[model samples]
Structures are given as C-alpha cells and as structure tokens.
Target: MRDINVSTEAHILEAAFAVFSQNPGASLADVAKHAGVGRATLHRHFAGRDDLIVALTLTAAQELDEAVETATAHCQTYTHALEVALGAILPLAARHMFLATEPAINDPRVAEVYASQTRDLTHDIDMAKAEGAFDPHVPTEWIVQAYDNLIYAGWAMVAAGDATPKQAAALAWRTLTQGTGNDAPSARNPWHPH
Candidate 1:
C-alpha cells in the first residue's frame, strides 16, 4: 500500500514536469492526463497546483544537491567541478527551469533551499577564484549569477533541440571562460575607440 502511494506520487510529479515544462500555465487536469491518473488520484497526492509545484521544486533542489556533490566529489579543481556540475544539471532543466519564474518559489521552504544552493555555489566560486580559475577582480556574486544564467541558456538550447546536453554544456563552459570575441591580435573591439 505504501509502495503504491509512493509510486503514484512519483508518477504525478513526473507528469507535472512534462506538462509544466511545455506549458507553465498547464492545469492540474493536464498533469492528470499526462500521468494517466484520474483527477481524484492526482488530487489525493497533491491537494492543489501549488502543492504540486512545491513538491516538484523540493524534488529538483534535492536532485541538484546530489548532482553537485557527486560531480565535485572526485574533482581536483573547483573549475572542473563547475564544468561537471553543469553537465549533470543541464539534463534536469525540465525538472527545474519552469520554476524559475513560478510564484511557488517564494514559499519559505523553497526559498530556504534556494538560499542554501546559492551559498554552496558561492563557496565553490570563491575556491575556483583562489585557484586562478576565475578572475579575482570580479565580484563573486556576479560570477555566480553568470554561471546560473549560463546554465539556463544551455538548458534552453537543449530544450529547443538546438544542441545536445553535452554540446550545450561545452558551449556554456567556453562562453564562461572565453567571451565571443576573435582572439587574434589584429581583432579589435568595434565598439571601442582607440
């Protein structure tokens, strides 16, 4: 009986991700249809849409925590860890990206998780800066924001079928380390006056 409850809940969450990722405005009925569960069963697992969103947000946060830990576990440098984390996280975009602008994220529980994630990533960025992997002159907060936005961009590329997750991750890494500029000495910034 417990197993069945857990299975149904998991199925509903999975369907929520699928339906919500494609359309943030999708209703609980859409999730029920996608999961092949009756509306009653869906409501039994989650009282309402906000409840479901919170569940999904918490689930995504837990998954991200695990991915970051596993990805960085064997890394010798924070930079490499960041790259590896990007690889691990890009595939989870469907589970998380939709929540970026969702009001449910303002829930205290979700905010706490997000705060912890920010602190962890900030520490990693500081460590990478110490290793000269990142510019010490730049604000750590800015770097953190850039890193997060890059992840979003990479995920968008993958979601749009413009690139595979691997390709998107590599592009994100390069964009982080190297701006979109010609490296040749003769190449000059057109916007800058000499």
Candidate 2:
C-alpha cells in the first residue's frame, strides 16, 4: 500500500513537470488536471508550485549525474567521457522544458541546484584537464564558468523563442567544445604524455 502511494506520488510529480514545463506559472489545479489526480490528492503530496519545482530541479540534477555516470562508465579519456555525459543530458533537455524559465527564478533552491551542477561540472573540468583535453591557455575556473554559462545560454535562447531545444543543445555543444577543447591533441595526452 505504501509502495502504491509512493508510485502515484511519483507519477503526479512527473505529470507536474510536464505541465509546468508548458506553463511555468501553472497552478496546482492545472497540475492536477495533467496528473489526472484530484486537487486534494495533488495537495496531499506536492502542496505547491515551489515544492513541485524543487522536485523537478532535483530530478534534472539526478538525470545529469546519471548521464555523467554512463558517460564515464567505459571512459578511458576525460574528453570522451564528458562528451558521453553531454549526450546523456540531451534527452533531459528535450523533455524538461521548464529549465528554460527556471534560471530566472530567485528561489534558494534555484541557486542550490545551480551550485550543485557547478560542482559536478567543475569535477568534469578537472578530469578533462588531467586528460589534457582543455586549452592550456584557459584557466580551469574559466572553463567551468563557460560550461555553466553555456547551459544558461541554451535555456535563454529557448526562452526567447530564438531556437528549439535541439538547436540550443547543438549550439551549446559547439560553444563548450570550442571554448575549452584542446587546441592540439598532439600537444599532450595526459594518459600517454611522452
């Protein structure tokens, strides 16, 4: 019985994310309709938009972490690993359209999630550096900041309706790689720097 209730709650939150992505300002009633749940039931669980949004953000963070995990699973090199991780996040971006609007939020959870992702990205930057994937001319901090900015820029472009999520993602890939990718793969391969 507890498991069933938990399942239903999870489904409702997924539905909430789907609805909120389409309508960032949607109310609980709106999410209830999307979740196919009564308003009372939705409130019994989520209670409010802030709760729902925080859950959605955390879901996204989990997805990103999983992406990194999968990417690093067979990873022999950091550059290849980061690329794989980015590939994993592609689907997340396509589905979680709410991320386009959430960066503008002043909520502490918003900042909290941002900081968490920053830490993860910095870890990747460090790995990439150790693997000799970064431009020697760039500071690791600058590379990390660029990666974070790229995420926001992709979301911003989607928010402005200048591009679709697919396009923003492609541009993000290009921007991040161009900004941080090693200028000469021959200069050094940390795995085999002779």
Candidate 3:
C-alpha cells in the first residue's frame, strides 16, 4: 500500500522478528517504525498481525533448517556435531522462543521442517551411541529428549540473563557430556580445586 519495494520486504521481516521477539504483542505500526518503513508498506506485505507471525515462524524454520545443515556439514564426531549444532541454533532459538507460545507455530507446514530436524537429531544420537560417545545403555529417544531440553534450557538461561550466550553454550556442552556426578578420576576436584 505504501512504498512496498521488492527489496524492503526482507528488511521488514527482520525488523518484525526483532520487535516480536521482545514484545509479542507489538503492533504493525511498531514493526513499521522499527523497519524504517511506512505502516502501509508493512500492511501491504502482511495483511495483518497474524500473517506476519506466520511469516516469521516460517522464516525461523527455514533458518533453522539451514543452520542444522551447516552445523553438521563436516561429519565430525557426534558430540562435536551436537556442540556446533547448539551453537548455531541458540541465537535462532532466542529469537523464535515466542513460537513456543503461539498456536500458529504448530502449523503443519512448519511442523514438517521441525520434524525433519528432530529426525536428524535422533540419527545423530544413534550415531553417538554406536560410537560410544554416549552411554550405550541410554535409550536414543531419552538422549534426544535431553538434548532438546538442554537447547531450550540454554536459551532460557540467556533470556533470563543468568548466563551470556557463550556461557550458556559452554554450560550446555559440559552438562550434556559430563553430568553433575563427581566420578571423574582427577587428582584434584575440578569444581573446588585446592
């Protein structure tokens, strides 16, 4: 409706994601101002707020698909793959965490992408078990669930300001690989070295 240039839509979407991530109830005018575009321009691209939300969800899913592919591209060890995958996905997860509360986030179209990601995670866990990276007795599904939980929890910690993104990633990797148990045979305790 107003200045809807073909090149500006990407800018509008990126601004919308930034706005919505902070304030899910943000108005289209808020998005437009943040995008440095006219309200009508945003409206022309997205008829209403719901349309914009759906578009954001789709964008996040697509980005996540690419991130996963890039993280696993080199066929490293399963633990390394998991570490890189978490590093790649954490920022996206922070942006899209709002999707967890939106009913439309479960749209079948986006669900397909999420399902593919899940399958990839499951396959990686299987590989980890086969390679003795994970405890062989742990079920693949349980490990997959723990991995998913850690990703969510890591982002949650970041959102809460309890940890920086770097610290969160390190915490997730350490917790996943070495649990809280004090079973390691070090001459001195790692947690309380004296």
| Best candidate, lDDT | 1
Per-residue lDDT over 130-152 for candidate 2, one digit per residue giving the tens place of the 0 to 100 score: 78777765677888877666766
Clashes of 3: 0
Question: How many residue pairs clash per model?
Answer: 0, 0, 0
Quote the positional error of residue 191 for candidate 2 in Å: 27
- The list of candidate 1 runs beyond 4 A from truth reads 179-194
- Assess candidate 2 and give its lDDT: 0.72
Please rank every candidate by TM-score, starting with the best.
Answer: 1, 3, 2
Candidate 2: pairs in clash: none
Measured by TM-score, the strongest candidate is 1
TM-score of each candidate structure, all chains considered together: 0.85, 0.76, 0.78
Question: Which residue runs does candidate 2 get wrong by more than 4 Å?
Answer: 103-116, 154-170, 184-194
Residue 9, model 3: lDDT of 83
- TM-score of candidate 3 against the unseen true structure: 0.78
> Residue 11, candidate 2: how far off, in angstroms?
1.4
- Native-structure RMSD, model 2: 5.9
Q: Total clashes, candidate 2?
A: 0
